[model samples]
Target chain A: MGDEKTQVHFGILGCAEIASKVCRAINLSPNSILRAISSRSIEKAKQFAIKNSLSESVKVYGSYEEVLDDPFVDAVYVPLPTSLHLKWAVLAAEKKKHVLLEKPTALDVGELDRILDACESNGVQFMDGSMWYHHPRTARMKEFISDPTLFGQVKTIYSSSSFFPPPQFFETNIRTKADLDAFGALGDAGWYCIGAILWAMNYKMPTTVTALPATIRNSDGVIMSTTVAFHWEQEGTTATFYCSFLSHETMDVLVLGSKGSFHVEDLIIPYEESSASFNFTSGASFADLHIGWNMKEQEVQVHNELPQEALMVKEFSRLVKGIKDSSIRPDTKWREVSRTSQVVLDALKLSVDSGFKRVYI
Target chain B: MGDEKTQVHFGILGCAEIASKVCRAINLSPNSILRAISSRSIEKAKQFAIKNSLSESVKVYGSYEEVLDDPFVDAVYVPLPTSLHLKWAVLAAEKKKHVLLEKPTALDVGELDRILDACESNGVQFMDGSMWYHHPRTARMKEFISDPTLFGQVKTIYSSSSFFPPPQFFETNIRTKADLDAFGALGDAGWYCIGAILWAMNYKMPTTVTALPATIRNSDGVIMSTTVAFHWEQEGTTATFYCSFLSHETMDVLVLGSKGSFHVEDLIIPYEESSASFNFTSGASFADLHIGWNMKEQEVQVHNELPQEALMVKEFSRLVKGIKDSSIRPDTKWREVSRTSQVVLDALKLSVDSGFKRVYI
Candidate 1:
């Protein structure tokens, strides 16, 4: 992913580790190009550019303001800390730059609403950095679960997104700092769980959100791990998700329906870059004598030419290009997805903070 | 499996649907034989024997008392409903017949205790018919999870057991009758979920059992579906399970540890009879650039000469033979396993009955 023909110029407002991945995605996308990168220190920005082997033509800036002020930049990918997202994302939108904000979009729905309002008023397209939605495998899974005969109504869903971080992370990582990333693992890893569940439910909010009593927190009162459950009364569907920084690496989601079910072990990142697969079964039942299943779970494989992150950038740039070239407005789908996920995340937070009470949505 | 050389003669009380499967298993095991089959009516017993293609040498008893009175019968397989377990199991034990009981072992632990105590006092062996426990795959999985470095400490576990039964099943099946199988799906299907979770935790009782508010019941006040949670305060481990007769067939168990994880889509009954496999990954981490996994989950296959039910019969017969010939005491392991499962099952029922309150174990 060296450099692609540029249609939309992109600027990154932070040097977070995730920013490096997005920077490459910008360069790889067919209609987007990396224009600039900024950190608090110009020296640090230069080091980050060197570390990621950025092209010489890509500008390096000392502060985020410089990137927003650059007239050529059409979009900004904000990978800043959670506490800084409201300020930086609104500023980018006000500067008339489309925004790809990292998740959990903001501290709470109030901050998310302010950011969304700014993007709407400024007429700038907004999307979160949940790259998995752009993976072709995701679309394939949705197709399977959406089939009336094959999948029927969803009965239950269970998702897990976790990783065991090194001991040093507790001492220095911004996620463990209340002021920097107060939501901690619930914001970092739990974002994917919420997004996956919401995606399965077609972004419909849950009737209730309840945190399990096993929430673990750091000394700074920042969550390190938690489990939450969601109930959709109308659909009679329930979902439970566990996100943690203390468990081994896992990005798994299982959805069971009346007639069919599917499981994906690597939902966030495919085990391979070029292809991914999930186990699916339809009309399964006990074989005669109850000795075995009537059907085995078939592994349905899906291939993609580009990685999910690149597809995400390509999709975002396509929306930005539409508004710039024609009179078309921004697509509201992505913002709505982010907003629903944020609202649920906020409810889970409230449930945990209130001694594991069940919070109605 | 034609009749094997007979060592431990088995007389089945109640020609329930599951009895046919176990009937075949008895004939398949090397050291076991089906000596007698019984039902309340001799005609029904004759019908069951004919339908299952039982050997002419197997006797058709008019009543369960007739099977127990036969001095040649060394063991009895009881597939009677939960309401009849206490009366029949204790009677079989008192008759000096080893007991192979179908599970949700009894209506409650109190009844299960009486059955176990009768077996102890009569010096007769006891085992519940949970066939999966005897599968070689179960032993292999136990090895993987026991490894200190490869699997590390168990962090969380999730189990699901569900199937969408025919509508007629809800109307006429014994499971739907209040007095026949009071626990309904909770006793029949949820039994496997509880057994699997406890098996993974080495049969330790959970600190607390909490049933979610999603319990669905039939008109007879029998639980048809439910979701429950278990927390092990000492190990900092949490487990959740969903069991129902209202979803597609699934017997899934997922165990996540500090350094490894595994998922088995078919835990109760394997997808195949001759061999089964589970997806396992140990010491897995993100690949460079967080684009993919460093290692893919490996599918570990385990093969068995006999099916799981046959293995279960063989194991139970072996223990019975040791006690009958060598004057050795009956093995306590099987009874202990059944006791723990019944204890947890009772807790789940109590939680559901008490308005989804958390029950301390």
Candidate 2:
């Protein structure tokens, strides 16, 4: 085992837009291989396999369950709509296969907890597929924030991720249907804001949150547009976030402190060609929109041109191979991620139902 | 009546810090005179009158009712704590006097509605003391927004106003008690956010709102911080606002449009000494924030250099003197302002009680 390179064969549950990128990453990596692909339609699965030039070795399955039952697959990536994340993640765990579930792992906390229990009981490794968290820029951001000389004492955080949704995407899709645990901007984009805030605030769930959800509508009636507010606390710090699906593409996160501030421009999907950079404050005096240090100069450039999904897959492979030491187990972090998502979604639901009431966690 | 130079004698209901400037303005203005001053203590009232050089002409009263009852006083300025605003404003109305009440006219809607009714029945002017709304800059801002060639189509509106509160101010103050109509930063400073958003969005009440409020508390259980998300909808337009009292001093308002963007720097309180300017962007093209045809000109300049309270008094004096039109009564705006505040505060309370449930108007 020491001399031999560990190999993990992977299958994808539903071939969504994000799955293609993950598949490409798996095919390119030496430690992992794309063993199978599945979709509700066999034609779609076959086309995916043939297009990737994996038809000779990779199997195509019509039913997601058939892919999960394959003994050759060591892990499965679930990129189904948010509503189905819990079901397939639990099934993969039951089959003794590690699972890499996409962002907003589940729609609510109750379901998320059940998924965690299933994974733990089966001794299956589970990881939330948050590729941004695996990127070097995220670590650099954490480091810059912790540095007293650079940021002084951390104070507030503001983030926004707004983009125009495809016109057809909002009609009866799992992501837009309220009965299927669908929320518009907050569920789709607001999770990023919540995740970023929690990460910067040392994983402290906001003690309370008061949100104003935008009144958005399609032919279908009122959908959420934007959520804006301050996340307050009895202790620690406060943060603010704005998320929208009605605007032009924008992804930025800014962190403010007493002495200076640090921000990551275009955080959602990093600019395709270059490494993400942070703008830090240079001096004691504050100026509008300033940047200070480069992580590359500090020798923190872990991966230069690798795709974000590739980086995440590489990290997950290392964790499964027992080559990486982690403070929280991959399984534990998976549960925590899902739980945090539920807390945020639940709070947002409460805000919407109660006409933007401030809810305490 | 025009030749008579009609004068309206004004009085202070509480010798609060804000009242001092009002006294000075009354002394300076040609159409109004400071007739009386009152505080809980006669000694304090006398000291305030003396400090402002109201020596022999201005009468000092021990109780607030005495000032309201004074026949010489045509209007009374109420700068009392939030809890006392409704009671005193109603009392002043009953005395047949016009009233200028500070922001958060009342903590809840019921109290605000009663005050409005009393003022209407008594035929007295009732204005929320948000004097900044009366500044010439506001008119200029409206003009900029209305001009299609300048701003094109308005898209998004963002505003934030945050400042630290004195330590003693949080202890048992009317602004900090939730049951007593005190509700953290939302009540203290978030009201300004409401006013700014309503102003920018053309005074449209939100069709729906979803908010997340922070649980902010001092050592003695006073709420010190809050963040609120207000999603407003009218026709097809939507706007978002973020307001807090816990963060550092920041006052910024940004309005993004399809063809261009307009930004108001230090919106709540612009620098008095320097010129106030904003940036306008139209797609790839950009220009200085303009009001009508002007570019890079000062947006908010008060040539008189008077305190905000003084500016408010001077404007009210002009209204009384028939030199300025009173048709745009502040009482009309106060109704909406107070109603919005009630909705927001009620939403905050519901959020806290229901563990951050979605609330509706």
Among all candidates shown, the one with the greatest DockQ: 1
Tell me the DockQ of each model, to 2 decimals: 0.73, 0.09
- Encode model 1's per-residue lDDT on A1-361: one tens digit a residue: 4335448899999899889889888878888999999999999999999999999989999999999999989999999989999999999999999999998899999999999999999999999999999999999999999999999988889999999988998999889999998899999999999999999999999998888777889899999888788888777678888889998999999999999999999999999998999999999999999988888989999998889999999999999989998857989999999999999999999998998887899
The segments of candidate 1 whose C-alpha lies over 4 angstroms from its true place after superposition are A1-6, B1-6
Q: Residue B237 in candidate 1 has what lDDT?
A: 81
TM-score for each candidate, following the candidate numbering: 0.98, 0.62
TM-score attained by model 1 = 0.98
Best by TM-score: 1
Sliding window of 10 residues with minimal summed lDDT for model 2 chain B: B285-294
**lDDT tens readout by residue for model 2, B10-54:** 788887666765676566555677778899999998888787777
lDDT (Cα) of model 1: 0.92
Q: How far in Å is the alpha carbon of A14 misplaced in model 2? A: 5.5
